[model samples]
Target: MPFDFPLIATIAAVFLLAGFVKGVIGLGLPTISVGLLSLVMAPAQAAALLIVPSVITNLQQMRPTATLLPLARRLWSMMLGVILGTLAAGGLIAGANAAGAAAALGAALVLYAAIGLIQVRFQVAPRHEAWAAPVVGGLTGMVTAATGVFVLPAVPYLQAIGLEKDALVQALGLSFLVSTLALALTLSGAGVFTWASVLTLVPALAGQVVGQWLRTRIDAVTFRRWFFAGLLALGAFLALRWLLA
Candidate 1:
């Protein structure tokens, strides 16, 4: 179905909001955007619309962080796992029904929010993490491509390793960028990208800028508390809507 004008405006507004939240919290752009957009569009279309903008916007988010080559080298194995996982789960995403897909995604967000509430911190040895990396990365990659879900069983492992904030942000950004690029290329081969998808970028970019600006003024802890709460709220709202519908 073609997008009506009102739908376009609503998506633009949601992206702008999602971006602001990401800027403040170091993540959430995709989660928030995907959650909100699925309300108005097919899950496949929502995922496609985000592919170009997420790559561009995440690059901007990653620009502020300094290089941590040593750390990056350590994480390469995890990245590899993410790639394999994406390839494994990528096909299932496009086939999911919109409401069912959204509900699944919403449940994941709720789980992430609950984990965030625990404020858990840990210290794991590299060897242990090395073993764990593939499992987490692969799951992260698959959900990211399909439903924009990037929480527990994926991101938490990165956080647990005591990765520095800047490096962590870049790592997350790079993961999404790589996976999305792969997804985009695959979809393009399958004739998925189109003018309407291209049209969604303008508002998405606008939101990214706004989100970055919001990032600076907020205290990190406060920002995270509210951010996760929003995720929980978004998930709850979606669940209720689905039940009602």
Candidate 2:
């Protein structure tokens, strides 16, 4: 497959921005990259381009070996649900029309932005985690399979679990890692995975370095405000584009 220079350029720019967002917030690489990429390509294609960068960056975030095993044990049920749900919905995005997938992606982004901006929080009792985790994971996986975004109930559920700040970040990384791998498997099975996504790694990592450097100097809260606002607008535009098409 010949690389389209313009499309590649767009991808580079999008991943750079997406990586920067992830560096600061510890998430959003796939969500932002796929959401923006869907503007120019199908959701499945955008998802393909994101697989490599998402996996690498997420692995970087899941650090401090001591914490990983504990977190993994606690979240194993959710992780299992993620894999099952993603595989179940694997063909939905690949089989959908471009416009339909774009609309789904756009709607996911919009819902995510709304949740972030409004700061919606939920509480899951410790005893309920066994049941709650799998359900949330399954829904999140279905969302990822359909739209290539995996933040919705997953992020909210993580926050509600009352993890300490550091634990929350690491947990997020672990959950995202699981989701990315599940999505990758689904994409591969659906014939949407592409080795060409490797080309995006450089720009994505470069942007992440810069964003991490800036994270220490800036107010993440303020930046998050602007980020959600921008995402809200972008999502609205994409959804409306589909509606009016």
Candidate 3:
């Protein structure tokens, strides 16, 4: 499809804003970008637009957390499970169930954030870690492909694990990288990776990389507060949309 000037401009602007937010907070680029893009494009096109930018930002984030291998290793099972779940969901992710699932996911995020504020934490012993990681990973994978609900659950768990802020951010970037590759592969196999979509990655990644670079100058506390606030607002919006329907 040839690009529409107004639509491309809007997508670029929205992505720039999303990139800035993600750069500051280390996440939210995809959720924000996807949500915003849906207003202008089909859902699949929106997702396709996000793939390169998300991957680029994750690669950028991954560089700093290179030494967090131990933590990453520990979380491998869950990550793998997420990949499997995404693969399993396939095109089913585009159905009516997706909207309902997305709304539920939004509600879950609000609840999780609320519980975190209340200091009601899940105890993650070694045994629990073993079980929780894979289960969470699968859920994350399914949600990522479906509507990005996967990150909401995993983010809280990452915080609960006492992973350093940098470590958590890196893990998130890695998670996105892995899951996106899986999605791309699936799309490729299904004959949906058109040349135009592949070409769009260049500009998308350029914007995302710029955002990642801008992140280092932000204050940590301020970044996190804004990050969670954005997530909360997004969750509420999603829930309301569902309720109205």
Candidate 4:
């Protein structure tokens, strides 16, 4: 199903913006893309279009073959929970439920940005990973199944673990990479992802390239301050859409 010219253009523009944000911050491809595209398409369809690009960016983050092994070892149980949880929710994640998920995603975004703006730190104690990882990963997977957004508790949990900043980022990358892969599998099983949606990847990837180039020239810390601010606005819009509906 080739999209109309206008729809194609909109998809391109959405990804261009989303990719730039991701390059600056190392996340938000799914959040930004799904949030914006939901305005014009079904949440599931919007999610479908994100499949290829999300995986590509996460792969970039989780690079150096050696980097993945330790994280994967540490994260495997949580990652397993993510995959299983998504599969379990497969039946309920469409139609009206998808809208509800969007609303929930919106609310979470608003809260997430608020937390980021305040520069507060939350920690997960080392002994708790056994219990916490599965719980957090399960919740994250359920949200991904429903909303195509998966940051929430997982990010804060990862951030708080007292890993060096680099390791934390790597953990985020790995988490997102697995989430994307799990989402792709879940969406494939649901039979909602189509060839046309996959085609959207070309433009999205192109936008990411431009975003990566721009990222090097900018101050990431300063940009992130503004980024969270913009995220607040975006979240409000999404919340309003749900309210208006």
Candidate 5:
């Protein structure tokens, strides 16, 4: 396939913005980039384009915070669920019926935003992590396979588990990193992921670094306001695409 410079430019721009969002917060690169890029490409292709950058950025976010062993031990069930769910649904991601998946992704985003905006915080006791992890992880994996975004149940579930702010952010990074790996493998198996797309890693990482730098100067509240608002709009756009399709 020829390297279409224009398309590459568009992708870089999208990743740049998406990376900034991640830098400002701790998530959103895959969600925002895949969601927006789908506007110009097929959902599967869009999802593939996000892989390299998402993996690197999430791993970068994950390394700096607390020890990984304990957190991973606690979250193992959920991670297992994520892998299983993703593998099972690989066909849809690799196939042509992305309309439904995109719609589902859109609905999920809107629902996630509504939940966050309403400030509904749930706390699952540590003792309950065993039973709860698999359920939430499984659901998140299923959603991720179909949509390339995995925040809904997992994020809320993490919040409910009562981790402190830094811990929560680190946990998010770890979860996303795991999801990205699972997602990438699933896509590769489905035969949609490509080496060409991996060329995007450098640009994406550059954007992520720039975003992180800028994050140091921004007000958290304002950043969040815009983030959710953007999410709401993106979700609506995706739903509209499905309705029209």
Candidate 6:
């Protein structure tokens, strides 16, 4: 846990890149950061370091609070399911050996990338949402607890339920915020949360600022394609490397 010069540099670089991705798409901070950091450290440790940055950055995404309450009310079942599922599976990653944790993280990244690349669209009828939301939420929470990434079924489910663009962004923020808080609690209970996690905030925040600035100049759609492609490669590398090791 000692932040030596090399380790500090690695953390700074990883967060900078991850933050940039999130700035452009309003997601990927935790996903990218945890995936990259797991290359050098245990997944549990990488996840611990991500807590502060993920919570803060996601909070920023939940802007224009005027519509927040209605979104929350609509998604409350899913949020509750996230909390329960996370709590139930809290020990999975922390209790795992380094190889197992790394492999799981890698697999999660690969799945996420595949989903993004496929760009599959699903429509959920309004009547079904009452039963569907919690199921998606619970699955997402279990995934979050295991891999420190929470965008799989949750993101797709949200998209399927039909929110406008702005509302979709805000909904993502809210869902992430809940997932993050729940993860933080579980990590803490597992004794994986470290005071050193706070040290990551400066570089992470700085990177997000730069990314947000660049977002205005770039074509996000093109960037997204490249991003998912890179993610797929990285995820494959990590999974293969550790599983074979």
How do all models score by TM-score?
Answer: 0.86, 0.97, 0.79, 0.91, 0.94, 0.96
lDDT of 5: 0.82
lDDT pick, better of 4 and 6: 6
lDDT of candidate model 4 versus the reference: 0.79
Per-residue lDDT over 119-200 for candidate 5, one digit per residue giving the tens place of the 0 to 100 score: 7879898888888999898888888888888896999999899887877787898889878888889888888887766777
What ranking emerges by lDDT with the best candidate at the front?
A: 2, 6, 5, 4, 1, 3
- CA displacement after TM-score superposition, residue 157 of candidate 4 (Å): 1.2
Ranking the candidates on TM-score from highest down gives 2, 6, 5, 4, 1, 3
Q: Write the per-residue lDDT of candidate 2 for residues 5-118, one digit (tens) a residue.
A: 897788899999999999888888988898898888888999888888888888788886787788889999999988899988887778858788889888888888998899
1 or 5, greater by TM-score: 5
Between which residue pairs do clashes occur in model 1? 16-207, 19-211, 20-211
Of 1 and 4, the candidate ranking higher by TM-score? 4
Q: Which stretches of candidate 2 lie over 4 Å from their true place?
A: none
RMSD to native, candidate 4: 1.9
Better of 1 and 4 by lDDT: 4
Model 1: residues with Cα > 4 Å off, grouped in runs:
1-3, 64-68, 189-191, 240-245
Q: What lDDT score belongs to each candidate, Candidate 1 first?
A: 0.70, 0.88, 0.67, 0.79, 0.82, 0.87
* Most accurate candidate by lDDT: 2
Q: Regarding TM-score, does 4 or 5 come out ahead?
A: 5
**lDDT value for model 3:** 0.67
Instruction: Return the lDDT, model 1, position 91.
Output: 52
Better of 2 and 3 by TM-score: 2
Worst 10 residues of 3 by lDDT: 191-200
